[model samples]
Target: MFVFTPTPGTTWNLTVDNFTQALHRREGDEAYIHTHADAEGSYGPRDEHDWWFAFSATGESWAGTGSPAAGDHEGVALDEATAGAAAEFAAWVLRELVPPGAGMEYNTRVGMESGLPDEVLTENTVTELDAVFRKHLKASSS
Candidate 1:
């Protein structure tokens, strides 16, 4: 899984509420976002693309991705299905959250552990993530 966060001192004060409010899904679309049962954020098993998106309150930003609801299945793997789902999730995130021309330096990491300030890899706008989303989701009109 991968993660992102607004750099400290940035004016963007992310809250779990924004994620709940930015709920957008095409009509008849099975994709959705639901507040986690216990956590201070949201989670959903999007069956449409076998992907899921999450909001971590601690990080005040994007959480990593994995199919927690892939009930009774093998664990997270880097196969095509896993990769596709992750790509789709990332696309949805950038499309729904990352405002156009957002200049805040967003911290990022590539581990499953999110919301930690000590593991910051690069504290900058990770435009590469946006590009990757565009590449994978270009053919998807939804």
Candidate 2:
């Protein structure tokens, strides 16, 4: 599991293998890679993001409802760098959880508030997220 504050009022919590069993039960395949993030509360001059993704040996897919769907909200609150950090963490987690693997792909939507540009927000988010991912990666390897 991974958790970080992208903004003052918003926190993003993401998990990869935590739902493996649930995916198998719901989709009938253990080879699936699943990730989900839930952002609660409006925070720090920005909106919230809540999204999910599931990939089978078949192809890429997303989870949730609506025309755009909740998954479309994946990185709405993040800048590109922070979003990249989040995406990298998700991808790495999927790769770590599944072996004999193929490449991965994803689609994400971000919500931007604040006069600040995405590049700025992303850089800051990335700095923090990179540390978090590295910590989890080391622990998982051990």
Specify the highest-lDDT model's number. Answer: 1
Number of colliding residue pairs in each model: 0, 5
Tens digit of per-residue lDDT, candidate 2, span 15-128: 333334434555674343413223543322222233333433213343321111233232221123333345544443333432232222222232222121222223223355
RMSD of 1: 12.9
TM-score of 1: 0.34
The total of clashing pairs for model 2 equals: 5
lDDT of 2 at 17: 36
List ranges where model 1 is wrong by over 4 Å.
7-12, 24-81, 103-142
TM-score of each: 0.34, 0.21
lDDT of residue 67 for candidate 1: 26
Q: Which stretches of candidate 2 lie above 4 Å from their native place?
A: 1-81, 110-142
